[model samples]
Target chain A: MNNVYLRNSVRFILLILLQVLVLDNINFRGYLNPYIYIMFILLLPFETPDWFILVSSFLVGFGVDLFSNTMGMHTAASVFIGFCRPGVLRFISSTRDYEQGMTPSIRDLGISWFLKYSIIIVLLHHIVFFYLEVFSFHEFFYTFWRVIISTIFTVIFIVIGQYLFYKKK
Target chain B: MRQLFRFLFKYYFFFLFVLLEVFAFIMIANNNYYQGGRMLNTANQLTGSIYQSYNNIFDYFNLKETNRQLAAENALLHAQNENSYVKITNKLFKVQDTTYKQQYQYVDAKVISSSTGKRNNYLMLNKGFEQGVRNDMAVVSPIGIVGIVNGVSNNFCSVMSLLHSEMKITAKIKKNNYLGTVVWEGGSYKTGTLLDIPSHVVISKGDTVITSGHSLDFPEGIPIGTVSYFKINQGDNTYKINITFFTDYKKLDYVYIVRNLFKEEQLKMKGVQHE
Candidate 1:
């Protein structure tokens, strides 16, 4: 249990540092800002309680918002994604039930399942995030453009990150 | 009651999610100025300390630029000193505890956290109520006026940065001393709007804009920016002037909180009836 705690903390710190120090600074023409930090929520163990998932996701999003200085935007998006993760997991799972203690990753879930899961989660998150940042229907098309571009970029980075770092335990 | 309890228990997670998201949206709406007052601002101790330490670690990378600016300011200050004036004859008559005195004191502080990209931006400084910082005090960077202090906690204070659309700094055209209000419309951080200047002022494009000091927070004649363009508002008989801000809010690090020592005296006049 202590080892599990230590590993989770390491992931939390590394992802937060990378997001704030590197990804936050990447303007990318103000449209394609990839949010790779949502991977933290995607990679949580399958058996983790739903309540735990939502709270943890909100906390991580609040951490990002603290540095970005756009209060509540990230938190609202992240909570929406967190609430929908279980449904996405069930929809994309090969089996009817996810195995206990199973963690979602490229190595553990196979390439196709991982890709589908990551895309769904990242896309839903980006949709909520970009729209919420605007908070109105005033610039519908421009905001939609940002949502689609950021979602694709974020999904691509999450896939790349899974292959680069995931390992069998 | 038992059935209701069971239903809630079965879907407790959904309820929790809805509650948290509602809380987040409320904060966002409040921050966007649907409501006013502090809403989980960085002046909170937890947020303040984290930003303070982060700034400390990252400040080293900007040492070269900071050093260069300091050196230039040092030279300018040196050139302005009066070293040769003979004032020995006035020493005998200089009295202590005379009528009234200087009414403003500046509390130096560092901006531990700041941002310029948002429509309503804010900067968090290291000073707080513990250090004599109070709500509505004027905060200014070395280059120009920043904004008013929004809230102060125990050890930190949050400022309404000039980039915020709601911020309005009273300013004057230094060339002719005509007054106007400085307002930010929020798309570009580089420029702000100066309104209410009469079209008859005949202002030039390069005129300097400085603080009017009508608001007791700031002293008179602090540099704000230079006028970039102006046109008569067809609807109103006022100049719709655009001015480039002198303070680059993105690079802001240090600020001074201007404390009005005579604030109590100034407020006392409001209690009396005017003829």
Candidate 2:
């Protein structure tokens, strides 16, 4: 258990540094910034308690926010995703079939179920984040375009990251 | 109590979800006052530094252009120095001393990161609070004015670039002295617009626009741009003048921060009078 904790902690730090130092600065056409750090919250063990997931999500996003100078957009999005994770899981997979301590993985949940799970959570997170950043519907259509475009890139990054980092280990 | 405990347990996930969502909502709402600013600024610095390193690698490709600009500036300075020498000789013959305390001083700095293709473009400089750069100091290139300093860190500062929508500089026609506000129209680095100029003013294409010196930030007579085109608004009596900026903001690498030494004293004096 201590070993598991240490590995996760190291991964967490590495992801934060990678996100802020490299990915955050890659503004593809100014609107397509893909935030892959949310993958950390997505990949947590299934048995991790609700409070731990929520708090961890908040801290991760707060860390990103602190560096990006955005006040709470990421934190809010992350917490929202954390809060909705269980519902998304149940909706995608039957409770009896999901082993208590077994983490959500492509091997466990199947690729289709995992994709659905990630899509819903990532969509919710991006919608909340982009809307909050825009802070107004005055440019409703323009902001909507930004949300859609950014979500596409973010989802792509999140999935690629998950595949590369969390492959059967 | 046992029954209540069972009920709570049955609805545990729902309660947890609601609680977490509420927490997120509170965080989002209160983000401005939270410590997020420091974190975001720290992150900006980290990312900015990395970008600076990458930019330095790409900057070598522009060495020829940079060299040409430096040579041009040197030639202009040499001409100005010669004129000053001649004026000194005349003043000496007349037994007069024209040397006086300068109200403005310029400090050279390099642009580490600049964005022009955004709705709210900003430029980051290599100099900051450690170098005596503070918020509201006017930044300019040899060609013309760039923007004002907005935020300052120990060794870096961010300027609200002229490309930002929120940027408004006091500019006037050098030929007729007709003043107007200069603002970016949200995109296209090649052009910005001047608003509030009266239609009666004879503003022609290629007329020079310079800073009004009305603000304590920018000293008078700083070059801004030249009038590219003008048209009378359909309903309003004002003319909309499009300006072609003198500085090629996209190719900007070096800039000078102009500090008004007497600004603090003047502001304090004005405050006393108002009080």
Question: Judged by DockQ, which candidate is best?
Answer: 1
lDDT of 1 by residue, B7-122 (tens): 99999989999998998898676654422445336467876887788889989988887777668767777777776445679558765666767888989899887756444677
Q: What is the TM-score of each predicted model, taking all chains together? A: 0.77, 0.71
Q: Fraction of true inter-chain Cα contacts (below 8 Å) kept per model? A: 0.38, 0.32
**Candidate topping TM-score:** 1
Candidate 2 lDDT over B177-218, as tens digits, reads: 888999986436768999999888887899999999988898
Q: Looking at the true structure's interface, with contacts defined as alpha carbon pairs within 8 Å between chains A and B, what fraction does model 1 recover?
A: 0.38
Candidate 1, residue B59: how far the Cα is off, in Å? 2.5
lDDT of each: 0.80, 0.76
TM-score of 1: 0.77
List, residue by residue over A55-169, the lDDT tens digit for candidate 1: 9999988888766656788889999999999999878766534666668887776878888888889889988887777667777787787777778888888888877886655
Regions more than 4 Å wrong, model 2:
A1-11, A28-30, A92-119, A159-169, B1-76, B83-100, B110-126, B141-146, B153-158, B162-165, B173-177, B184-193, B199-210, B220-232, B239-254, B268-275
